[model samples]
Target chain A: MKRRNLFIFAVLAALGSGPANAACSFSNEVPIKVLSAAFEAWKSVTDAMAECGNVQASLDQDFRLKQSAAFAANPALYQLGGVANNTIPQLLNEKRIRPLNDLVEKYGQHLKPNQLIKVGGDIVAIAMMVNTQEFAYRKDIFDELGLDVPKTYDQVFEAAEKIRQSGKVDYPLGGMTMSGWNMALEWLNVYASLAGDSFLNADGTPNFNNENGIKALELLKRASEYMDPEYLVSDSTFVQQQMQQGKIAMANIWASRAGAADNEAESKVVGKIYTAASPLAAEDARPVAMLFWDGIVIPRNISDEAAEAAFRVAMEGLDTEMVQAHNDDAVWLIEGYKPGRLAEGAVATASAQPSPISYPMTIEMGLIHSAIGNQISGFFTGAKSAEAALRAAEEEYGTAAREAGLLQ
Target chain B: MRFRTFAAFVAPSLLLMVLFIAAPLTSVFVQSFFVTQPQIQRVETERCTAGFLEQQCTTEIKNVPVLDENGAVVTTTRFVGLDNYRAVVRPDRAFAALSAWDWQALMSIDFWKALRFTLTFTLVTLPLVVGLGLAIALAVNNTMRSIRGPVIFVSLLPFIVTPVIGALSIRWLFVGDGILTRAMEAWSGTEIAMFAQGWTIELLMLFYRVWHVAPFAFVIFYAGLQTMNRETLEAAMVDGASRFERLRYVIVPHLMPLIVFVSLIHLMDAYRVFEEVVGFRSQAHVISLQWLTYDLLQPDDAGNRAVSRASASAMLTMIGIVILLVPLLRKSWRDHKGAR
Candidate 1:
């Protein structure tokens, strides 16, 4: 009787393993490695890819810092990399990523037309999702205070004032104001909304040191007054937690985090949060946001066989089946993705009159972004005036640009 | 010992020091004087990215690195003497701010700001660590033997924890609505935010460094206390010396060498304060020289890092540590010569 029972258990274990292999249409033979950002969408995609076997995915928040150097190795450390608009330039400029036109033509029958990221008329990356910062707020509190959904910065400030007076939450506003990359992105969003597509001159020198720059700085300072006093340490996750815990009433948070509001396990105020298009900095300008896309790229240093295998596995990961299972994970560009209610803010912002600009994929923009991140905190800390902070950022950008050989 | 034995004993460690420490230091010193940059060219290119419902294409002139025939970025290494250092120190801006009597402007510069905090953090915590450590050693010395072990264990717990983890633990204890902060708020009947300002964060960092390191000082001082000359202490006692008088005249004099040793170690460690800035996430409010170097080395989104500037900052940090140790080294040298 015991031997029969053991034999039956072994049979059951074999049955359990059968479907795991059957889920992927093809059995992968190559040992492929992928490096990507650690996020919900990447997790879903990579897990789907793992079904094909021999795929090792490293999900790290610091993937950008490693991607370029890893891809530049004689035999690339990773066969595939996940990148966004801002992170793809270094790989492109170094000629480290291969053009995927032939691979796409062979195996990308299911890929959408808009999914191909082309530079110099050659497909380089296959975008999976679109992301942007949008206006997220606690709808319950807004209705309780009889406040309308804010469309412009002034209306947002007025609504924030009303919420503050009502004593409904700990703070009337939350922001990704942590003093490095987050703060720099916040500055760019506001600056671009006020002065569109003028980040640099034709010669790659900074061009945001005039009236629009000061106004953007002043607006950020104003917004900080309605936020928590510890705003300088508040990153996206912190602000997301603040919203989920019902501590903050409103924030211009990432669209990727909107699903967390309804996560019953962690959120205290489930279904109480809502999102809308990002508020405009001016009447006629676009929303105060920038569009970003997360995608996969094949590395040039890998052998053609590895690249082909990696691309096929990537396609399997990004198939309609994955999107159907993880529809709300991101604003997926895949065909089967059904944009849920949480995607409304991102969709509305993207389709608005005078839609927001995609983040620049240029070498000079990277230096400028770092310079702004390093120096802009002084304006809010009361250490420097807005003009002085802008001047300092320009000077910092100049130094870095010169070092990078973008400036003489 | 025979000369051959001495050579065998010393050779391995000396070789390791040269291979690990001296080689890297020389590389960094050389790197600080030179700049390696990719050759860049301006080009007009059309790029397309995914939009929500469609694709957005734009044409712009971008600065892109020139790639060689073999698909590697072409780079040029040049000896740019003092340029990286000048970029970091910015003497022109510093002198301008100084001459104008603009303290805020001077502090806005990264190097000067980091230096001010690093110096204060090092100097302020040194005496406190020594004092607290000495006090604990004296208390532990007078305690009953049975309780001494547990007391010492409890005191050494903070030191046993990893430095970054210890800082993070303290941060959680006080960060936003943490239990300690909530209790303090209840006690004071007012709201408090510990990380809302620069000085409060600096104060917390100093407190944490003292708390974490005083146990190390305590263990060393406790060891020194066991070898204390009982006769000298008894002589002071019979001479009608009060407890304070004995401690001042006999006990402190005997512990002076140990104090200097701990001071030298603490100064070297404290001058490179980095974990607290990261664990506390106080980059916006305050920064240290070590953190500044790390920041320069960290790659941005576009994979750009100021490697030469980072090396320069590292060299400056080492120079600072050497200057701080000069006085202590001089005293130790004098004492050694006198003994000889």
Candidate 2:
């Protein structure tokens, strides 16, 4: 089987300008679980890894649940899996995935120093790509309206109001405030940047019901008014569709989804969409964005031999050859990744911001997110006041924290 | 049969029940009385960069039950009796809210919120499911024999569809700019966002529940209708009873047992609602007790689960089901006794 795969790989390499120095080879089989959206990128790596080893990729958007369940139920079922940045903290704390420091030193010669996911003093995962939410707008509409690129949330509102009054677009903005998880992340993005480093204080008590919390809630509610009437149901796809159909002029959406805006088949306003850094909440505030890394983790319960094979396959998949081949699909962390036409906006967005902080991966942050996801929508719908919403959020967070033993 | 033979014959089923049902139920009950929280320990390590003379140390908090030779946690689960129940029920908070007459705040607790929706969903959908099911059963029964088979098949289609799919299909029809949504907008000349608010979502969920579940009741009633006494129905007609009166007095009385059966089944099923919340993505506005338990069992950001809380929620839901089933069980028991 190994010889057959190597033969197939050599033929494919001959057919395409495959990696000339494809030296790594293995006989073991490795099964990978990853998000379906990143399948194209994974496909390149899997195919490349096939030359040396048997590699299988299981594509699922519910990778978090799958990874956790697989590790809990039967870790040997999979050898390698990917997890989002926000999910890393849980995976690390649970010790479901073993420390990759030894493996990295042994097998990751081509890996960059910055790509290592260090929790405490040990490397646990190696990030393949970076993803974050950023400002995306219709450049043509901005030019026609003579609107300057919005640098602050106030400017964004002004532009939205002008666009709304001009009747150029049905909705001036798009939002991903779908009631639960997405909305929670949206609140986190705005609050964490505007309010400061953390939602909890040093002692892990609830601390978001302050002036900053109220302001963030008010800003969210105000910004929501300019979005689709069904903003509460609007997720990334809905907002993307709104942009595609020319219903909205601008949005803060994931950089990973920016390429979809220019897909001519699904878009009416193709080439009109442009991406930039997220609008600031205050004059000197951090950009209202959260950086996320998509990385692979090998469960600790898997056989050492399997883990080694999985690590080797993963490294081969994330090598320079694979990155250059599928760089357009994501903002790659690998070396030799040149930003393509589709990635130009995300590149500009990332470079423009002062290195956005990752979404905090602590359990308290997750609980705080649950609070925001559950209660903050009340403020948006006028069911509760901003102050009341903030208070409710704090109350929920406190209860959850105490219950989870994160606080006294 | 001899007593020993009877016991031997029943032993397998009893053993199976003890292993599968009784054991898990007992475990969940036991788990409800306990709570599991992260076990943390602080460790100090000295750092000497150049020499031992200039040494510094730092202390860090670690999640551990007991540290191994390599400082890895060997065990993390810690048991706290009754704390899981306390956390979910929050007796102190509930009392505070009640004493203060803060009804809104009282409903803010997750358990209370989920319980409110679960009860509302079950109670509201119960009668509608029964009535609609009976109505459809009668309509199909009255149809000509040639079309009866096809009519019954069409009536069964809703129940035949997967529950999640059925709920999702209904949800999409009413969600933003869906076909029905657009039609409503056009007819009313006003935009509608059916999923934006809790009440609207609840109404939609109730409607979906009826649409999806009524067929089961209908099939049962229709089968019962076939076994109705023809002579009694004819006698009722000859005695000048109207169609409504015949249905009310004769048919309903005859089908009371089947109606009870359907009600018992619906109560048990509806009280444990989970799929609809997920299908409609309505957790933002509405949640059910089963969903709450499932949500608790979900891995936190640290990969560990709220197992004790989930177990407590399961126990509470089971108790609710048992409470709802008591009267029906009592009625059946009385019927059995009277029949004997």
Cα lDDT tens digits for candidate 1, A1-408: 667545533543442333334468897878788999999999888878877766778899889988888998989999989999999998999888999999999999878889999998999999999999889988889898889999999999999999999999999999999998899999999999988889887677887689989989899999999999989989999998998889999999899998999899999988888889999998998899999999999999989999999999999989999899899899999988887877788889988889998998888778888899999998888888898899999999998888888888
**What interface RMSD does every candidate have?**
0.9, 8.8
Residue A325 lDDT (model 2): 64
Q: Give the TM-score of candidate 2.
A: 0.89
DockQ of each: 0.84, 0.24
Report how far residue A182 has shifted in candidate 1, in Å: 0.5
Worst 10 residues of 1 chain A by lDDT: A11-20
* lDDT (tens digit, per residue) of candidate 1 on B278-315: 99999887899999999999888888899999999999
The CA lDDT of each predicted structure is: 0.91, 0.76
Tens digit per residue, CA lDDT, model 2, A310-361: 7887887788877776777788878888876556555555555454456655
Index of the highest-TM-score prediction = 1
Which 10 consecutive positions of candidate 2 chain A have the poorest summed lDDT?
Answer: A29-38
User: What TM-score would chain B receive for each of the candidates shown?
Assistant: 0.98, 0.90
DockQ of 1: 0.84
Over the stretch B222-312, how does candidate 2's per-residue lDDT look in tens digits? 9999999999999999999999999999999999999999999999999999999998887767789999899878765545467788898
